[model samples]
Target chain A: MSKKPVKGEYIETDTGNKVSRRSQIIGTTNIILGGKTVIQAEVIIRGDLLRTYTSSNPGEKQGNPVAVAIGRYCFFSRGCELRPPGKLYKGQFSHYPLKIADHVFIGPGSIIEAALIGSHVNIGANCVVGKFAIIKDYVRILDGTVVPPNMVIPSFSIVAGRPGRVVGEIAEGEVDGMDLREVYREVRN
Target chain B: MSNKRQSMMPPAPKPPTSLSSSIVIAEHASLTGTKLIMIGSNTVIHPRAKLNSAYAPITIGSTCIISERSQIGILKEPEDEEEAEPVVIENGVVVEVGAIVEARRVGEGSVIEVNARIGKGAVLGKHCKIGPLCEVAEGEVLPDFTVIFGNGMRRIDNSGVEDLKMKMVARQVEVLRKLIPSNIAKFQ
Candidate 1:
């Protein structure tokens, strides 16, 4: 058996991101990542599941081919998956792009198919953020909670339970703990 | 992606799987143990599936189907005090896509659905059905024919569909065994 890769093991990019070699990222041309993102081992990003349709509006992002777009300082833990949500829109089945904003941390073994995840969100381990779900800024999703598809989560709220219900709000002081710079500094072999 | 027959680390020199002659592991499936991971006859492991036995040995029985991206034999947490034992999966088990299993024992004909997690040291009894996205807590003991679903609701199952499913899985194994080359020579 292979020994566990150490906590300090990672590949440092020119843009300051830390990515593990053991991560399974398919079709890199279709995935966009902002600087300083941390992608841990065993994380699966399905960038190949792109939109099959050509949009009429040139200004719409649906015309572009990006499947998973992540912002700065985001952290994805081991065994998590990022797959674009698909649906039949305007009589055509297409997989939409997954857009995640800054300072978001997704925990281990979570499967994310959300349409939008706003800034400073913290999702705990083993949670399932369903397809087309909209999670607003500063939201915290508890472990093992399954957020149903297309649920619009309000900002700064803590969500738990199956098909997720808002339980509490995050205090203003707690947002500072979402910074990933300290973790970025230590994630090097 | 599957690792090459030669491992990168010097501490683990042997090829990482012990497959029976009829077993079919896809080219992209990854096994991370030489002496600790064993597969029985007529088992089918799909692409992108991972089996890691670093902290413990793993024994998978005959006629098992481990679907794509499903994980087996995850290590126990650091805070866990008990010594890790082998993860044992009995005959005719089906672990569907993307599920993570680190259980101590998975009994015969159990069906673990998509994205479900079986935590460390948990024991699943015969013919149990763990529904999609369900979470079985660490060290929990589930009885035979138990069905877990719908926001953690559970009950003893009396459904008699396992025999038909077993025959179907056997047919699948027969087909896959012919398609995927028996790569046991390189591993053993």
Candidate 2:
């Protein structure tokens, strides 16, 4: 059966973000947190925390350090795995990095691979953000996703999946706030 | 030098006729650019869209709607194996605008929504809603009423689908096995 998250419970984003389906925020689990350190979600200061040790190799990168610039009033679902930003590789090989800005709403089962993600971005469920991908601000991605490596996603765009094609640009002045409580309510009913 | 009257007047352009849905095709749509093969009557197809059957055949039942601005790429295997047949889209399926279906069969009452993509050799069972922008990967089979709307790795990482996709090259090896007609006759 497909694993879906229950309502009002907080799942920690240790080593990775919560990547489950339809988790709730009303229960004892308050913060969807990451890491063994004391830095808790919804309490950490909203800014770039340069805590990740950049390494080009996955073998060299130990203990999965993820850097988060989480903003106020944002909703994150379960099973979202946010690995550390930027893989700094030396020598004559291709290198990749992931940069997530503030107020980014990531859905369940989404994989962000060394991507440049801007603020106010809403990523749909089960999407794969490939290496070196650039996603601009105010972007909404639909479900069942695959973004190829080295591709650029402009601002205010809505992308649906299937070999990942860009259908149309979202019009300006359409600011939709993605509240976790609202999404949780919708999923429960 | 024969002073033949050169036909200076361009031949009168034929008037555009309102295409009826009931026109009988002398050749199948496979010969033309249409990938969808309609079994029943009263199916409508837009003029602007490109329906290609180079890879597979899309079979559609009667009373289907192939909307405008939809590009159907009924694709076969990327590297052709001699044995693989065309893809099929069964009858009574509605493919919306901007939806692309590359599969062999989309069963009856299945709706491939706008901007949705059904991958090569994928099967959509009856009454399924392939939600907008969803990507159903190659050879992935969905049972009836299986509403999948998001992207995912076809199987759990390197073990399941990675092995299956790699073995896809041998799918055409069955054609060579069928070529020995004399051996079959001896068995009979």
Candidate 3:
């Protein structure tokens, strides 16, 4: 029997990130991906919506100008989008950075416009995380959930519904399953 | 030699659509169909937004923000006997991510939230708000200040804060103009 060599589907970067060739990542200069991350095909990461407002403190360091920052062992599934949240503040409109911590997994076709997502978070398919929504650590957002704008989700919560609300809690033992380290390894390409 | 030189210079191609100089259209935004698409000044069209004018023309007013994956245009042509009306979006309208707008007229300062669908020929009055994932049936007419929200609930917003909201939309357009680099020449 002849063995066929399967072609890899992802482009592995030097920093141990596996990014698909078909991903539509805009404004690449403003995006920071930590090592061991996997970005699947057709995923759109909008890093162009950077903060336009400047602080008054001239002496303070400008620091990093990143618009979308994702930490280690994260996974973005096919057709998902990551967009920084923007709002009108004090009569000025500015986009805030989307910060995602380690071991996060976002499912297919989900549109995330959250300001912050903590570690070990798993967002299911076709979900919409609204503007400035803060999802804390070890949370599971079920499929098709539409989290309202400015919602703050606590840790270890299971959120579901149109205007998403915490329907249940994630047990301590189940928290281990939320980690995306194993899922990252499984995407060999 | 003079004839050869004249032959080498190709004629300039005519632009298919009309766009104001101050509008910001991203490089990846799709503008399809044979009919004319007229976009006014200070409008920001995000990447991957689809504007199809195959069945009828589309007129988008000033200071509008059309977000990513949102589709604008009529779903189909009108019946053989009737004429297809153009899709009209007035000033300060906001169509959020992944929304489908096939409205005959989306009134001034209206907002269509993410993933919502405004069906064919719907006439929305000024300052209407359609919430996320909501569906407005085809040819439906919504009054001014109508807010369609959770579980298809309807309400009228009489807070008299429309001026403030319109100001916010204008500010958002200003910020987006700087953030989204426009390649209007490519579309032309």
Candidate 4:
């Protein structure tokens, strides 16, 4: 008889992050997960691609060493991937950190290589948010949308299509539904 | 091409019927119901690729590459059908990273790219290219040399340039064989 993988299989971190053992997370040391986040099975967070370039800004060291910084109450569904964006700057290859703000929900099979994703963003299934794209607060990306590289998405907007465009606006009252507390509670075995 | 004939060496070698001894399956791969799966010689299944043949038998031909997070025969066969036929993938196919192929037939030298989905009962012909992030709808039939690309666009690519692609895939398979540890006995 084949044994079924047990449901509600999650490890509760000291910071309240519920991570699945089946998730393939490389370079865990380079990832910073805030409290109450959920990383589901088959989710890959690639932290091995670290920044090789020194800080070009004033008063900074060569290697600060952070690849992925995810905020509170974020839910990464099964088969999704979070990859840090990399580029050649000054003829040197380097990867930048993927910064995700609070209350974000990424659906299954989606690939995120965005530089910045603001709070309360809900990206639907199989969407691909491209490299260095900046997304502001309260954004909802419809299922199967592909957000092109370096694109900017404004707040309170709903985006869809291939190379995603603004399709609609989110009502002010709908903001509360974006809270991930209920979703977090339901994920428990 | 020599590997193709060797894989067809008759059903007499039938004691260990399903899983082939010549295939390289990663130790971490989840192979549920191995009795329902048949992998030809020189196939390299990357670590973490899920091949669940519990519902339907899956037959993958020689020198195929199943990449990480890619799956074959994993999804439950569509419920409405009275009986779902087994999936058949012919020789020299490359199923790339994160692809989900539940097709009825994947022909020779086909390349299923990253994050692509081949829906249930789809038939992809010889040297077909299913581009990254694309989706072939369920039961769709694609002829040989068909190239499906960005945003559901498709066209026939009959330039006959599979030699370079096969060489690159072979090199990738060589690297993967060294990178991922194999445990063929675990499923056998």
Top of the candidates by lDDT:
3
Summarize candidate 2's per-residue lDDT along A1-189 as a digit string, tens digits. 536553432333444333232331111122223222122222211112123324557787364333343343344444444432222233212222345665566766565553577777888876756556788888888876767656798888888765567877777666666333344333321
Q: Which is the better candidate, 1 or 2, if ranked by lDDT? A: 1
lDDT score for residue A73 of model 4: 97
Candidate 1 lDDT, tens digit per residue, A40-139? 9989887766766577978876445798999998999998988787665665556789999998999998889899999989999988887799999999
lDDT of 1 at B29: 77
Pull out the clashing pairs in model 1: none
Model 1 interface RMSD over true interface Cα atoms = 9.4
Best by TM-score: 3
- The parts of candidate 3 lying over 4 Å away from their true place are A1-8, B1-15, B77-83
What lDDT does candidate 2 reach at residue B165?
23
Chain A TM-score of each candidate structure, as shown: 0.91, 0.55, 0.94, 0.93
- In model 1, where do residues sit more than 4 Å from their true spots? A1-8, A56-64, B1-5, B8-47, B50-67, B71-97, B100-113, B117-131, B135-149, B154-188
Docking level of model 2: incorrect
| Residue pairs of candidate 4 with colliding backbone atoms | none
Distance (Å) between predicted and true CA of A21, model 2?
47
Q: What interface root-mean-square deviation (Å) does model 4 yield?
A: 6.4
Error of 1 at A17 (Å): 1.0
Q: What is candidate 4's lDDT per residue for B42-134, written digit by digit as tens? A: 899866787867667889998898877888873874577576767899988988668899899999999887688998889999999987689
Q: Provide the lDDT at B38 for model 3.
A: 95
- Alpha-carbon shift of residue B140 in model 1 (angstroms): 17
Ranking by DockQ: 3, 4, 1, 2
DockQ of 2: 0.03
